[model samples]
Target chain A: MLLVAPAALYVLVFQIVPVVYGLILSFTEYTPLQRGAPTFVGLQNYAALVGDADFRGALWVTARYTLQVLPVTIAIALVLALLANRSFRGVGIFRSALYVPHIVSLTAVSMIWLWMYSQNGLINDILGTFNLSPQHWLNEPSSALNGVSVMRIWKALGSNMVLLLAGLQTIPKNLYEAASIDGAGRWHLFRHVTLPGLRPMLIYVIATDIIYLSQSFAEIFVLTSGGPLRSTTTVNYLIYTEAFEYSNMGSASAMAFVLFAFIAALTLIALRGGRER
Target chain B: MDRNERHTVYPANRRTFLKTSTAVLGSSLLVSACGGPSGGGSGADGDLTVWWPGVNPTEQDFVTEVLIPAFTEKTGRGAQATFIDWPDMSTRLNAGFSSGTGPDVYGHGPAAVADLVQYGRVEPLDDNLDQLDESDRKDLQTGLESGLVDDVHYLYPIASTGRQVAYNAEHFTDAGLDPDTPPTTFVSLREAAEQLAVHKSGKLQRAGIVFSAEAVGMQQAFTSILWAHGGEMFSEDGTSVLFTSDEGVEALTWYASLYQGDAPVDDNLGGTWDGLPPAQSPLATGDTSMTFTDPATLKQIMDAAPELDLRFMDVLAFDEGDEPAAFGGAATGLMINPDSQMQDDAWEFLKLTGSKDYNSMYAQEVGIVPVRASAIDTDYVKASPAMASAVANSEAFRSNPNIPAWTKIRDTLAQYLEQALNGQGTPKEALDAAAAEIEPILAEGR
Candidate 1:
């Protein structure tokens, strides 16, 4: 009990207190720059969120981005992990190369992709070589979020692959060997043995990925600034703009709670679906 | 026996040592708790701290090597200054204030005055300005009018920027246009853009003019063009929105046309120019031949491409004979912290910042035009004829509305403008949409 006291106290002071304070702030008109204490305004801040087109738009954007990024990232990562799992020459090098992007900072990755998406950037240069017109990667409302989604999917691939690979290693060798001895084909063995083995890790990856993808900010901030028409503005990005840019702390806090509720609901559904599986 | 004796003495000595150390530590802690940066809540007495953002090395050198020493010599006080990047300035200011360790003086854009005043974080400068000499007062009056809120001046104008047309003289010559004469009217501007744009197989190889779609505070770029065509974004009383008016619709229509191949620009071609790193500017790479930008940015363009020939003119207007109005004024200013204990010392520094002599030196070193009308005749100002002309003609420059919600308003306007530019909506629809949204915010603010 004594040993846990310090850690518990730290969490209570840092995390729990702030969350409680933020909850209280959500019902008030609070700005750090203001002269006096925050003025409580009941449910006005939360009520305003319901009618804010930008807020609703951001929620929709965040959902679409998550839908696009999560499944694609998991699928590609699983394929990469499967390839890397097979015994081959210099396999360690291949694994390390695959994992390199995971070690790099997200901001650095986003900046590199920003250059690639620029009008005269490498992406356009490649398109030019193929005699195709350069596409506006981030400027069009139709394609902007998809462009960010691609970059995010690439960024998330390595970590997911590594996690899935670890899950593959955990599967009993005898299970696969027995399945093969029973005349199971490669496809049959993978479907029956490998998939069941990887389910727990897959669930973990999907849950974490959803949480992370929903909270995407730096990529949108770096690549598009939530523009060419608010197509890329995530709820998290709008919350940031509200708090830091507009200094509307109360409104930002309200938005944060709404996002929290959203993430919690998704997390519950993910956990339940995993249990059923 | 000697060892036993030594042990006894050691224990006694340890007790004595502990007593003395506790006394010293207690006293030091008390001193530290009571005395922060003297005169400041965090810094020492007689020490002044000034916070400015994104000042170049030369500008910093001038502040450190010239201004601080001169200030100290003049007032018998020491001063320290910290430079923050522009994006981080607001966050830092908020954190500093919340922590109760804010600087004695800080610089912010003119648009921040309403918020600053509303928060009661800045000291009103009416008394300070009243102490100025008559000529100095007159010089500051016209510029300071924008910083005034409800008869109380919250920001002191330190520097000004006016958005004017900048053309690549080399590009003009290459495109068979006059290198010396840039466009002064919308018709000529569009013509020049069409002539200078280079297209290959339906792709824009080189844009004639480009707008910054992702630049920080890009609303100013659009508003400059809007105002140039005699459009008002808000009513005179600021009680209601007016951007849906015919003038506003016309301004946005013309601006949208720039992105539609009606001019040299196309929706898919422009890149983030302003608020990007100096090197990433399209004008620096000679991809775009013309833009509406400030002199400081133009200076940056010169730094990025020293060999490139550049020229500046007033922003294009609707009527050829009408004087072109630029959309910039007093973007940066110094305000004394209302909570500061070192207000007297800070005031001395603020007065120095407002002087012609200091401004001239600052302008020379920083490559920014001085806010002081008296400082317009300096050697640095004389060297840049175009900037000098802009600064001298203060009547031609207009600042954005200084309101608490200006940042939000600007961002909302930028979104709708992009919607129009990207063919998501018509210009009229976009402006009307923005007006619908912003009028409510403005009303709430009122």
Candidate 2:
């Protein structure tokens, strides 16, 4: 009990307490600027959310952003992981290069990507060289979310790749050997042996990825600022603007709990599917 | 011990562990909930704590090296100043105020004054204003007026700001326009822009003019135009939306028209050049002939390209012979915390910031408009034509309504304005939608 005290206290203070406080706050009308205890308004904040077009739009954007980025990130990371898992010349350098984006600060990475997506930025310059029209990558509604997604996928690739690479190493050589002895081709061995072996780590990666990706704010903040028509306004982005910018902590907290519930449900669904498989 | 013995021992121990842990957690929770220093305590030894917004290096150096030291020397009271970036100011202030550890004096834009007043977070400065002589008060009237919420002063204005048309004289000359005579009206400005704009292969290579189109910027640009057309954002009491007036539609139409016609003046629809380095600005890069920008950006462009014939126009109106107006006022100013134990010291600090010597020096160093109207006589304003123009037209500057919900209202309006600019809806439709949405926020704020 004493050994577990510090970790338990840390969680209780930092995580559990805040979560409970936030849950309580969601049912009240509060602003940090206002004095006195929060006024209990029951579900008024949540009810207001039901009528808020912006909040509903934000929900769609969040889900779309998650769905758009997750599979692409996972697939690309898996491919990179497979290549890095092999013993080759300068493999460490290759792995390090792939992992650099993960280590760089998200804000810093977003800044660089912000420039790259500008009208006269590197991306447009490349297009210009090929005699193609320059694109307003972050300015247009159609491409703004996608533009942020590209940066997010790039940033997430390194960490996901490292996790999957570790998973790749844990797959016993005997499984591949046994499959090979049975006249199974490389594709068959990957589908049956390698995939099943990687399942647990993949499940862990997907669940966590969904959680983080759904709460994406920094990239959206730096790159688009939930524009050009709020195409990139995620739920977290909305929550932040609500709490800080508008000073409507109750509404913001309600939005946060709704987002938390969503992430929980999505994570559960992913975990259950992975377990079933 | 055998496996069976170990299991039995572990279960018994676990029960004891759980009970003790629960008790410990409960105590900790109770202790934490009840503990911590109460809000509204004076700083250690009564030293003033100040949170000044903006992390500009020059401003930081001036405050820390010159201002604070001078204050201590004058009054024998020490002050600690912390510089915060503009975007992070509200978040930090919110956290600080909630914890009751907020500074004795903090600086923010006038737009935030109402919200602070609404929550009784700020000290009213009406009493402090009496300390200034008649002449000093008169000199500071424009900025002082901006700091008022419900006709009561709250913020001690430090800097004044105005948005005006900053043009490249070289571009005007090259486009066969008179360099000395810049457009005095928006209509003529558009006409000048048509001649100045350069296009190749259906792509705009050079924008004749560019207004700021990024988030908050769009609202400012639109408000400038709206006011120029004699439209108001809200009624005098700030309870009604009036930007949906016919004048507002005309203003929005004119703003939207900049990017609408076959010969569009602006190329980058939603791009931001406001906070870019001087070298990267569209004016410096020759990407635009004229830009609607703040004094700081205009001055930076001049300094970055000394050889270029850069000039700024006074605030422009929609039509000739109409009153010219721009969205501007107290850019930033200091407010005292009501909970501060050092209100007198805080007020003294604010007075120092508003004084001619400090205000002029701050304006000169930071490249912002001084709060005093008399600052026009200062050598810095005389030396910089951009500053002179801002100071000359200080009377024409307007700002968002001083309401607690102004920021929210501004953002809400900005969204619809963006939609109108993008051709998603007519100006009338957008403004009506914005007004409808903003009505409740205004009512709630009231």
Candidate 3:
């Protein structure tokens, strides 16, 4: 009761209710503002979704972003964790320094990164030293998504590094010693003992990445706002645009459901693939 | 880890219960001590709440120098002003209106007013509106009648604003074009733009115009071209969309031709529909030569870049087709919530803010053009070198069709127009698609 009841109540009050209400709204021509009221028609919004070119485009962008950010953030975090796991003189200090960003606010991180990505910002300032011309890092439609992905990668690294640290610590030293006695090389030792030990943690990390990537709103909201053009319009951002800005709550909910199905399918496939590996 | 070792039962359980009951008794006693009112009930009923969203410093100056003092002197009602961004305002307002609370009087865009009125959230100003002096009120331009929903005025059109071509005079002369004579025809406008444009290296240095037709801003821009070519968004009866007409197609073609590839129809992807990452745009840096702007936005630009050296031109006349029409909208005005508790007091504060002296003061501080023709500074309009032509041409401005669902239609039009500009669809296809989507929405209200 203690474990499930509190979370269940919380989900019921905020998440489940809103999702149910939103799903119910998907078939109706529900615009809260202007003239007219909601009138439900079964499968209408779904039919519209099926035909929407913009929705397809958004799905493509979301898949591309998730693929780009997920592996990159994971690889970088693993590298950081490996480096900080060593017993150097300032190893403890380095570990804390690596963990600092995990505790820092997202708004602060996004703001700092936004400044860093600006034309006259840190990256541009460095490029200028080599006599290269400054580029609008977050301005061009092509680079805006990449720029946001880089910031997310930086943010994702901290938390993943912490998880990796826990995974690294749990791997028995006796296993490494046994591998060493068997004349296993450093690569073989790591492959045999460390990799297998970290598999569970890897699965947990991958699941987290799936959930986080699907709901990547803040960085997009603070950064390019799906812009230069609709080049960066993710499914969630697209849903928000339809609901709040256009007042097409009905269509927005339909879009939301479509996004949910997509992410859910991808997550299931990912978990199955991880298990197979 | 043993159960016996883990016993750390709290001693404060009984004490906490006793203290909580005592605190409740103490709180009741405290309430009794404070005596007969809803504990610190709003400092005074004399204080009024007004909502406006614009340049904060300018709004602050207006409140400090004009509205507050004038209201206090006339009726002794102190005003509490709140600022909200125009885009996020609808959400906040809807939330507030749903709950019967906050702010006695507020201001919003004319179209937003229509939506709010439908919800029965705002109070009708017919009583005080009728009380406005007949002669003084007549001077309020008829274009302000756009605030009317169902033939009943839901908003007070406090000030007038319109779009005009803002250009750098220094560049105009250097480009071998006469500063006095701006473009009057579509061909000449293109020629002028070509002359004014400056590029260096691979980077685009300066452009003649930004083709993006934002909702409030560039509405005049793209629409003016359409108007000059004998196209409009709606028919006179407000029943049909006229965007796909031959004139509109020609206008779209002309606009798209300026850019070699991927014209900047809307850098934010129709602004509201798709939010963009926060970064400095070329327009923000004054990288464009001639751009359309309303007076208040122009004033804001000048404030942001005081070194801005620019000239203003009104909407141009067509060669032989249609009359010129600039886009216009209101700044802000006092609106009472019908659901407000203090109805009579709110009305009194509204009257104070709307008084000729107080209102005019409000206008000057906020950099708004006077809505009432009587208040258009006779000396300033005649002599102010910069604003004289604008003042003269202000009379020719027109409002976009006041259909309530026009926001959706307008955004949809922008998207299709963007597609047409990029050669994805013909101008006619774009317009026809928009009309097909919008026709039902317009018919819904009727």
Candidate 4:
């Protein structure tokens, strides 16, 4: 028990205390600027959330953003993992190059993406070579979310590929040999052997991706600022604005808890699906 | 091991657990206290700490290299200044206040003053103003008035800001318009914009004029237009939303029309060019012939592209005879933390910043409009046309209501204004929706 005390104390101080305090705050009307203790207004903040149009819109945007980015990112990442898994010359370099985006700070990556999506940016410049018109990637509501999603997919691919690559290495080479002897084709081998083996890592990747993607703030803030009419305002962005911009900490905390509940439910569903498979 | 066997091996008991928990908790608290901001508690005397809102390299250098040294030299006391980016200012300040680590002196826009005042977080500056001589007080009267909340001075304004239409002289001449006389009203401005607009294959090649279309910028642009049309954002008492008035709808209609018509004068919606490096500005890049921008940006553009004859029009009205107005005033200013042991020191620092010499030096170095009216005679203002125009029209500048909930209300309205600009709804509908959302916030603030 004495040996376990340090880790326990760290969690108690850093994690548990903050979560409990946040939970307590969700029931009160608090602004850090105000002197004295937070005023207890139990359930009022949560109740207000139900009728908040902006909050509701943000929830939808968050869900859409997650759903839009996850499957595409996973698919591309898996393909990259498979390619990198092969024993080829410079494969190490290829893997490293692919992982660069993941290691880069999200803010830095977002800044680059912001420029790349601008009217005279690299992406449009390339399109101009094909005699295509310049596109307002981050300006229009129709294309803004997709523009962010593409950057996210690119950013998330590296980390997901690395995880899948690690999972691929753990699979027995004998399984592939046996599948080949059994006359299994490449697709059949992947479906029957590689997939089952990689399911655990895939589950981990998807669950973590959902959590991260659903809470995206920095990119949205730097790129579009949840604009062209709140088309990209995620719940996290709204919660941030509520808490810091407006200093309505109680309502912001309520939004956070609601978001937490959503993330929990989605994660549970992913876990249950993984288990079923 | 089974649960009972494990318990027996550990010999755990309630008393033992309680003692262990207490020790850990006590130590954690001690560590936390030690790790917190140094000299943070109220009445802890030391050198003054200031958090200036803005990370402009020039401003940062001026504060560090010039201002701090001056303060220390004059007072025989040390000072620390932290340059915070504008967007992060409120968040950091909130965190500091909550943690009892707020600086002795901090700067934010006047919009935040009311909220700080409401919470008793800031000290009233009326007494401080009384210490100044009549000439100094009168010189800063306009800026000082802007920082008032319920007739009480809260922030000591360091600079003034105004948004004016910056036009290209060559574009005007090329469009068969006189470069000497600029548009005085929104009506004539739009007409000029139409003539100046360049289109290729039904696409805007060069915008005639660009108003900031991003969320925050849109609100400012709309506020400028609303004020020009003689519309107020709220009633005098600030209890009710007045932006839903017919004049507001008309102002928004004209503003939205710029991006809506077949021959749209502006193309970039939900994108901002306000704070971009001078070379990349729409006017500098020739992407737009005219744009609504502040004095600092305009001056930078002139310096960056001297060959391009850039001129700023005075604040515009809706009609030739009406009072011209623009969304600006008290861009950023300092407030004293009431709990600071160094309130006198903080005020001294603020006085130095607000002094005529420092004010003029700051304007010259930072390219911000000086808060003092006397700065007009300064060589910097006389030499720069943009600075001269801003100073001359200081009375035309208006700002968002200084209410506790103004930021939230502004953002709420900005979202709807964006919707309107993007054709999600008519201007009237957007204003109605915004007014509906804002009314409650306004009432709560009151």
TM-scores for the candidates: 0.89, 0.95, 0.79, 0.95
lDDT of 4 by residue, B254-365 (tens): 8888999676898888887543467877888898999998998799889999999999998999876778999887887888988788878889999999999998999889
Candidate 4 colliding pairs: none
- Give one digit per residue, the lDDT tens place, for model 2 in A112-217: 8877886667998999899998787887788889999999999999999999999999999998999999999989988999899999999999999999999999
- Model 3 segments beyond 4 Å from truth? A1-16, A23-43, A87-141, B1-51, B54-82, B102-104, B123-127, B184-186, B201-203, B211-220, B261-286, B318-322, B341-351, B354-356, B363-393
- Considering the two chains of model 4, state its CAPRI-style docking category: medium
Q: Which is the better candidate, 1 or 3, if ranked by TM-score?
A: 1
lDDT of 1 by residue, A111-227 (tens): 888888876678989998998887878877778899999999989999999999999999999999999999999999889999999999999999999899899999988888887
Model 1: residues with Cα > 4 Å off, grouped in runs: B1-46, B55-62, B138-143, B215-218, B261-264, B268-271, B274-277, B364-367, B374-376, B382-395
> Model 2, range B88-198, lDDT digits (tens) per residue?
999988878777778999999988989999988899999879877899898888788888999999988999888999999988888899989889888898899999999
TM-score of chain A of 3: 0.92
- Candidate 4 ranges beyond 4 A from true positions: B7-15, B18-45, B274-276
Fnat per predicted structure, each in turn: 0.37, 0.43, 0.06, 0.54
Model 4 chain B: ten consecutive residues of lowest lDDT: B32-41
Q: Could you list the chain B TM-scores for each candidate?
A: 0.85, 0.93, 0.76, 0.93
Instruction: Give the alpha carbon lDDT tens digit for every residue of B1-446 in model 3.
Output: 67755443533664664465456545643442232211111234557666666546876787666767766776666777777776677665644543333467777766666556655667777776787777755666443465666666666766666667667677788889888887776667677877777665644557766544333333446677787666787876678878778877787777666654533322222222112221233344655667655555555455555565666776765454557765664545557766455666667766665555656666666556656555556543343333444556666666666666666666666666656654566667877887897888778755
Residue B202 lDDT in candidate 4: 88
Better of 3 and 4 by lDDT: 4
Best candidate (score: DockQ): 4
User: What DockQ does candidate 4 have relative to the true complex?
Assistant: 0.49
